[model samples]
Target chain A: MGSYNWNWPILLKEPYFGWIVSGFGKTILIAVFAWAIAFPLGSAIGIARTADNRALRLAGTVYVDIFRNIPLLVQMFLWYFVVPELLPADWGRWVKRDMPYPQFITAVACLGLYTASRVGEQVRSGIEAIPRGQRDAGLAMGLTPTQVYRYVLIPVAYRTIIPPLTSDFLGVFKNSSLALTIGVLELTSQARQIEEYTFAAFEAFTVATVLYCLVTGLVIVIMRIVESRTRIAGTIAVGAQ
Target chain B: MFGSFDFGILLANAPFLWNGMLLTLQLTALAVTGGLLLGVVLAVLRLSPIKPLAWVVEAYVNFLRSMPLILVIFWFYTLVPKLIGRPVSGFYSVLIAFVMFEAAYYSEIIRAGISSVRRGQISAAMALGLTKMQSMRYVILPQAVRNMVPVLLTQSIVMLQDTSLVYVVGLRDFLTSADIVASRDNRPTELYMFVAIVFLVICFSASRLANQLRRRYSL
Candidate 1:
């Protein structure tokens, strides 16, 4: 009992206070960066998988298979600690020296790449869900294949994938905690710091839990709205009963 | 620099890596098995006639689903030991966390599978003079389980990949062991590439098996 003391005042004071706020900022930054990178890359990979070109499909499949199978933490550590060292000496030096946010870069890159595999699958399904006649109609209207995809395929696919994409966004948000291992000061890292500084593990983690729930809750609400709005007509009516 | 990535190092460390691999598989097996059992129970609870029971299960699922796995792992590691006033091994701690975290997800999957079962199947089973429990046991469960194989396999692959996260808790799983070897030898790219390949092989096989099952069971 003596070991557990309630110290709300200490938690709110200098250093601890700044650390938590910055940690929250970093977590949001990591999630946003990861999502931004993942979406385009994943969409490209997804498009590539269904492309008529064999090589593109092969490359896309391999990339998705490899990235999706491995764990995020392992990939992050590899990128952060291993990849730079394997580079040519001068290049490695530049990377090691010039990169101020090595951990952050690694976190974002790993999370993005990992998430891209999932989003790629979602995008592929979304595109496939679109009727082939739509693409034919685009072609019939004198649009090139590229134009057809950009103008017709992509817009429809993006809209269709919104629900899955939202879940992926949440996944990236949760996975950002892996960044803490590489020493990026995210929410979980800040909690660890607070616990170390004040020995208030329970309170620090409780705060983190609340913050996580709040962010995830917000994402869920937004996704539900997007899902309902974008839902195909009569699907729910038919689904419900 | 590590002398052009010596295969000899990996060969020498093969035994250690094998141990870690065994632990990783064991962890995934235990977690998935425990999770599925707990998940089925929660799924049943979610579908129970009692409103309060269903509400409790829903809350549990939502809370677990929303929380990060790392935080859950950490919380369980700390709370379990403190509450019991005895040290739980890191291995069991991770297993417990995985089961708890995964059960929520599995419950949803199971529920979906159950719901997808046609309504008339139950009525027809009742028409055969079977009790409601007997109908579910003899008819609904088999059909749901059959249709659920592919999805469950996918979830199993996810659990396999997620086992790597246990490294954070200092468990000597494959990823942690690879990290140790890579850090010690300074050959991060080669070692991590190897680890990635191992995971790819495992997941690829699981997915292939899932596909085969899907084709076999296709209506």
Candidate 2:
């Protein structure tokens, strides 16, 4: 029988603490950068899907469907392996050899683009839920279609979808762990490394599990605040996904 | 760059990929069925009037939902054999992990579906001398399941995508098959492209079907 030599202080000590804390930092960094890209990219695609032109709508739909349906892990590998090779030879060489932190770049891009598809879906649905008359009124008031969306459609849609958006934000945070599959040294990977080093498989993951719950729990609280503060009066009933 | 795109290599590996695809589909089916049933129970318990029990359910869902799927996969891959006193296969470990992990997401969908049913309907069922469980079974659940099917299926798409994670435990699902072939043949681009397309086609069609079902069933 194996002896149960549990040391809670292992997490408080040198290499383990640094590994986990930095891993947490990386997870947040990847999620934040990804969301930064996803938000604008998604809004553009969302607007495109809601456009009157068929080609634009179709383009948006195709982008969302292709990216959303493909698994993130597959897409991650595609970005890491295939996308580089498909670039021009010199550029491909740079990505493969010379570029700094290519894995991180690929992880961020894959997660950002993948998440944009989902955010676009939510954005489109949120915009569609707005009354058609609002668009008409903005047009009647001498607003361009773009201006109408920018001024009239977007603000309300964003407010309405805050709850769903919160969940998606949480989704991105969780998904960032997938980056470790491509050698990003994010939280999950660091936990695995710790387990390998200390031979305390359970302890390493226990710390990680607690850290995840804490971060997610904090995000929920902050998002709840945002949801309430920005909520339109009597419009969006609070809901869970 | 794509001008010289090679289908010949990918076509030659179709049978190899198919084996993995089948495993992926099998994992999805098993996980979805087990998860959905378990999720329904969790949802009911979450919504039950028993405060302590509801809190316990809430904690379970919250804790699991917060953690990443890969972490859960790792935990189960190592932890299960310890609990059972015998080593289990990668396939069994992954299946059990996926079902438990997916149940959290499915529970929320089911809970939302249940709450979407009008309160008046439940009251009316009770007025007709139906017990709470009986009313939920005969009246509420039928409607909830109908409304929830589309969302459930949408989550199934996510699960199907997630089955690729079983590759980490060396369970040779679709992505892993493509991976094995790619590493062996040094045709990573072609094989990955092929696998990605297969995933895209299946998930896209399934999503369309879900939308159709949503329109047909949603009240």
Candidate 3:
């Protein structure tokens, strides 16, 4: 067997180090893009699930089911490769030409849709967790259904669902690495690239893993703070010490 | 335009897709079994009498839970073989990675189920001349396992979907095979629609199965 020289210090020099730093930036960018899109869409789908109209509820339910069940990678491929082809020729050409960031867009859409399903479920459960009398009281006061939901149901439900929503957000952040398969140069993808260049697999991935843990840990801390502040007084206690 | 939906292309690729489907099922089954075994061990560790052991298990679960499964998959694919001075097969690496990652998650679910078992039951078991292990094995485990049916099923379904990430390591799972066919045929839309439909069917069935289990067990 041939012995190969492995130099960790040299690997961290100049351009190599810059790439790792930029990779971190790209990861944060991907996570932010996905979360920003997913949160509101999830909230809407969640609200729709609780509507009076059965058809709307059904539509929302089906949407959530389809997205939640399929893998994000499959969905990203569909959005990037498949959906573009289905468009009209000029539009398809435009998408192929103008959309340099198809991978990023697809990542955001996939994460958003996937996270929305889980968030929708959380939202539904949160709303259900709130006592029915609150809605009834809102109705007695002559508030419209939208007003009741907007002013009463949603705020309370949002508060209750914050913890789960935080976890979902963290999941989105982690899952954004799937974008690499589609050519987005996020953290994992960049790490893979570095490993290919230098064959320093451990150093590359260990750094990536630590960065992921840092981001997710920050999310957990923020969620705990939110959970503490918004907790309904004496209603439910947090189980984790 | 790809000249409308082509049932012909789909029919032509059905056999290949079937092969891919079989592989997907194989990977999912293997990974789910591995996950369950690892999950059970970690669950026990998390509930161990020793505080340090519990803390270590908690950290493992937290780290695995936080890290993306794709990263874990990549880590196994790249680092494990390199670290061990051998090249591991992509399929086995993926399986191992899934097991390690999902175990942490499922362990938490199992731990939750175990903890949810009333304290009285354990005390009663102890009072009946049973050792701690015996009490856990007989009284706590049965109820915990029963209560965990729904969550365990859901986790399995999620794992099934997550198997698609194996494509990153160049594994020819369902999604990868479909990608190849799509790229080769230059009909990404039709091919992906087919892929999506396949995923939808599998996931929906799994979820339905989970619901059935939940109903049957009344967990």
Candidate 4:
């Protein structure tokens, strides 16, 4: 076996350092953009899952099942490689050739869509976890079903589910690394690129690992603050024994 | 709208995809087994009276949990071969990565499962003159495992979906097999759609089963 060299300085050097920064930026971009799509869409689907109409609930369930069951990597490939081809010819050409940051767009769409299924489940459970009496009380008070959800259900559900939503938010950041598979140049792929260029796999991955931990750690800390701040004051704490 | 798709391509590549599916199952089984075995150890250590041991285990789980699995896979794919002074096969490398990475998750689950058991059970076991190990083995673990069954099943489903990342190391898991055939036949849409359907069926059914088990066990 050849002797392995430990080179730490390479990561701090010019192009590689720039790559890491840009890659980190892209990772944040993907997560934030994906959340922008996932939050409202997921809340809507979650609401639909509990809707009185059978068709609406079924549609929501179907959406969640299809999106959640398939692996995100496969979805990434389909969105990037297959979706364009299925469109009209000119549209296909435009998506394939002329769309700006096509890979980034595809990655955001895939991650957003996939995460929505999970968030929708969380939202549905949050809504379901409310006492049955609350809904009945809302209806008795002359509120429409939609108004009941908007006024009595969604607000409480969203607050109660903040902890789980925090995890999902972190998941979006972690899953955004898959964007690299579609050529999105996210942090993980940039690590792979650095390894390819320098053959210092250990150094490259070490830096990447540190950066990931830092981001996730920061997210956790911030979320803890959010959890405390947004916590309902009067209700019994969830998961209290 | 999907009139242009040729289902024949999927039919022709059925055997290849089946083999890929088998590999996916094989990897998932190995990783889950290894992960759980190691996870049990880690969880036990984490909850042990030894503070340093617990701290080390806690750090290991936390740091690993915070990172992208693809990076971990890449790390082990390179690191394992160097550490062993031999070129490890991609399958073994990936297996190592997955077992290590998944152990963190499973340990958390196992830790929760263990904690979910009432403290009275352990005290009662000791009062019955059972050794600590015997109490853990015969009393606590049995109860914990029962509570953990549903969650373990759900994690297994996630692991199955995660097996697709083996494509990074050029292992021909189910999705990768579809990718190969898609590129070869120039039928990306058909093959990927087929891939999605297969995963959908397996995962959806398994998740439903898990939910049923969860409901049953909760009662």
Provide the TM-score of chain A alone for each candidate, in the order shown.
0.90, 0.95, 0.93, 0.95
Best by TM-score: 2
lDDT comparison, 1 vs 3, better candidate: 1
Q: Rate the local accuracy (lDDT) of all candidates.
A: 0.85, 0.90, 0.84, 0.90
lDDT of 2 by residue, A37-100 (tens): 9989988899899999999999999999999899999999999989988899999898899888
Comparing to the true complex, what docking class would candidate 3 get?
Answer: medium
Better of 3 and 4 by lDDT: 4
Lowest summed lDDT window (length 10), candidate 4 chain B: B210-219
**DockQ-best of 1 and 4:** 4
Q: What stretches of model 3 exceed 4 Å from their correct place?
A: A1-6, A238-241, B127-130
- TM-score per prediction, in order, is 0.93, 0.96, 0.94, 0.95
Where in model 1 is the C-alpha error above 4 Å?
Answer: A1-9, A232-241, B1-3, B127-129
Judge the docking of candidate 4 as incorrect, acceptable, medium or high: medium
> Candidates 2 and 3: which is better by DockQ?
2
Off by over 4 Å in 2: A1-4, B2-4
Q: Which pairs of residues collide in model 1?
A: none
> Lowest-scoring 10 consecutive residues by lDDT in candidate 1 chain B?
B77-86
Can you write out model 3's per-residue Cα lDDT over B1-219, one digit (the tens) per residue? 545777788889888888888888999898889889999999988989899999999999999988888889988886566666888778887888988999998898899999989999998999999998899899998888888988898988889889888888878888888888888987778878888887889789889888887788754
lDDT tens digits by residue: candidate 3, A110-167: 7777888888888887888789999999999999999999999998888877878888
Q: State the lDDT of candidate 4 residue by residue for A1-241, as single tens digits.
A: 3699888999999899999999999999999999999998999999999999999999999999999899989899989988888888999999989999899999999999999999999999999999989999999999999999999998899888887888898889999999988888989999899999999788888888898899999888887777778778897556310
The positional error of residue B47 in candidate 4, measured at the CA in angstroms, is: 1.4
What stretches of model 4 exceed 4 Å from their correct place? A235-241, B120-139
lDDT of model 4 at position B74 = 92
Order of candidate numbers by lDDT, starting with the best: 4, 2, 1, 3
